[model samples]
Target: MNARLPERQASRALLIGSSRFSHEGLHDLPATVNNVRALADALTDPALGGLDPSGCRVLTDPTTPQQVGDAIDGVVNEALDTLLVYYSGHGMLNQRGELFLAVETTDPDPRRVHYFGVPMGWLRSALADSPARNRILILDCCFSGHATQAMSGTAPAVSGNLDIHGTYTLASAPAHETAVAPVGAQFTAFTGELLRTLRQGVPDGGELLTLGDIYPALTRALLASGMPRPQRLGTGMADHIALARNRAYRPATPSTVKPRTVSEPRGTTITPGVRSTNEQDPKVAAEFHAAMLDGYRRAKKELNYNAGNFIQMVQQVGGLEAARRLLRASSVSSGFTTLWEKGRLDLAVEAVVLQDRFAGLFSDEELDIARDRLAEYGYSPAQTS
Candidate 1:
């Protein structure tokens, strides 16, 4: 499991939005402004961590690298406080293999980066030397994954809950892939999901959203949205460093906890990995659900995995009613959990069909294991005949 959260501390955020650039070839990224504002609002909300607005600094379209550096210098020296640096703009890599954040007056030419770009190496050095107990760097720009490799080290998606007391970096895309910001969307693709994770809260039975909770959710959210996977990098006292309180969530109880199963009339209570008490027979559907949990449990042993959160995410993205429709449509009078496991009849087709129906909820490994197990039993997922 990820280490438990460290003590709460004073939190401050620096949000940089560069929508308008001086270079003629570069187009303005209007979503940058939207991304910053949305995040800033979440940070300052009283129901959240109740962060002081004065501690948050947002810079837009800075004219030079010095301006960005000055902003970084202001926050890096802060001690025993949580410091967040978020950049939403264009990012580029120069010939010298340095990652740079494009300044407002940045020249987009690939060869002449020193003119208007802020070196990521400089940013990394400042963060490494910081005295603050909590440090987070979030980059929502192109070539952001490069910044992580430039840092300490890149980590796989966090499995267990842990406090991120040392330093953590979240990059929107890999070193080569381009990040996305749909033209009409209010915020950039990555930031939109970040804010959603904060607002929706993890179902991990806590008011605080930690690094482990956010990264996987962001990964799944981006995959569902058809965007490149986000990457997390760095290591040091990495545990539950609380980012924000989950305002839209409350701990599940015997009363409010919904059954994550198909029941007679389909009662409104659900949790992952277990069934709820509801009468009525949808045994086939329930068997399918059981198979899903079986596959998932096998895939996530080390992680303090919460199947419910993944289900909750699917409900949020596709709507609860839509999910109910799926359960009902897929339900049958007779069921076969044992046969399904043994790859009997069309169980492979059945599993694949179910996967296609709710493809968003699974991670790559979980899906692969499920397929592999069925294949071992002579079940071909694609061959219905």
Candidate 2:
């Protein structure tokens, strides 16, 4: 059994939205504005009392680059437990592979325009200097991948760096792709789906769900909704960071967490040597057991049943236990039983079948034990004919 770890403290988030323009004349920034509002709503929503929005803050306006920089610096300097940075606007890249966030003052002039967006290198520095255990950087603007590329290329390798222990960065599109916002949508498809998943809650093994479990679900949902695959820019550390930071952000009604099952076809017969298990679906499980029994019958009739094939089917359906019984009953080398036990169920089944076929082995006592086990597991061992 796995031991439980100590619970970490809650996280803090910093949201920056730049919709108004100071120089490049308002670029019709509805998406960014809406994203800011939506996030604010979710945090302040009484339903999210667990999140504790009092510590969170949002900054958006026609500010100078210095003001934007100061806001980021102030938040990181506080050294909060978890720091989440969300930016919704434009992103650009220079010939040097450097990335920038386009702020209000960013010049549109192709030759002389200066990009005011946040530099990923600078962001990494802030995270590295902060005391926060986990850091999440989410960019919803165009050219999101560029930031990831910049960080991966230039960020320091120190363990305490925000880019190390608990750092996660998610981009909406590939490095060169454009991020499109559907009409009437509050945010881009990726962001929308992410919020929806978080709001609905992530699914875990049973009723308990965590942020780690939600990432894959969100990825699938985004793909199903026609959004491009969001790039995962970190390692296991990224998952740890997101989970530790988002623990305070839980959903009210968690999604279902049922395990998957395989089924069998209809009209199959079973035999005494046939074995099955409760691990799989009833019908499919029965079908697999029936196939194993049929194989033995065929070998008895034609004197040429492929033991290898029978073992394979059993392994695919039941597991090592079933395969061992088959091998022992077939009078195959019992010496291989220990080896098969150590192998994967499928592999063990294959080994048993191969041994049975080449050695022409039979274990009557073992077969009888298998048949009894099948009956105990609720499988029918009698053939219809």
Candidate 3:
């Protein structure tokens, strides 16, 4: 079941690509061109699963920077519910810390170069002018630091310190480093990872992947790919901001499966009649249990709670199962109760996995109690006899 937020309207995105430039001077121009087209193709491709191409409006291979700016102007002017601007090309930084797109101009002098690219200042201003509540800007080009530098001063102006409501800028690399492109690939490593995660969909508490869920996955995937880690500029609260504004973003939600229950006896301390067994590392199980308790406490205080958050914390402690039961136990909206119940057995397995981790941390009696509680919830421990 797709979790529905307050808003039900489909979201709109604007994809802009500048591959063939009028200017012949920039290095790696061909790669930049290809990457943008590749990114557009990825977004439009149905195989990616989550993102629907019907929601996106793409503009590729703009010959001039003005054409790029014009494309953005048209999208923002429409005042769509959600606006995403993606640019892959050359970026330049001036002495004043201003970032510009390398645009086409007759003058070629490096000192007085007419930066043909759209100004970071103008992009931000355009977002400000738009009626859309969520504005996302992704830049995959060289010398992109200026983009962040331009938006730094405005970060504080956003509500709740979240960047998603305003103009959120994601750069391919830091200011000092150069963005890299692989042969035949259209996008840089960082952009590719970002697209992959967004397309793959994140695992939210139970099959519901939110914008927040995708961010970490994207970050981890990019780093794991052994590519240049893109620098995320602007406020770090983009996802939160987007959610707060009720924008249309897709979430990945997994199907529910029934849980199998198992029971055992207490042998050593508690009741002298408990035995437990499971396939999990004892130390990891203990840590997973501790993390769940800690996360529960934190969630209660924040009043900003979700079963997925707890599930994620538990998984971090051990594995997927451990997180599932904690999620079932936690208070969820009525719509999600059936999902939790169906997956109860899987959650039990997770608890057992965590119990194994806790074995070494607690005394025999404590272990028995933990094991019993898990059993009470339908998780069967490994056979000791």
RMSD of each: 12.6, 14.7, 11.4
lDDT of 3 by residue, 173-215 (tens): 7766666677676556766676665455543222433344444
Could you tell me which 10 consecutive residues in candidate 3 have the lowest summed lDDT? 330-339
Which candidate number maximizes TM-score?
1
Q: What lDDT tens digits, residue by residue, belong to model 2 across residues 67-139?
A: 7678778778664566777787766665454556767777644333345545666676776677776666788
Per-model TM against the reference? 0.63, 0.57, 0.55
lDDT of 2 at 296: 48
Give the residue spans of candidate 3 off by over 4 A.
1-10, 22-24, 31-34, 41-55, 104-110, 113-115, 154-167, 202-209, 233-237, 240-385
Candidate 2: stretches off by over 4 Å: 1-10, 22-26, 43-50, 108-115, 154-163, 203-211, 241-385
Compared with the true structure, what per-residue lDDT tens digits does model 1 show for residues 127-244? 6677767788899999898877767533232122333347888899988888898898898899999998888886532466667557766776688779998877545433356677
The C-alpha local distance difference test score for the whole of candidate 3 amounts to 0.50
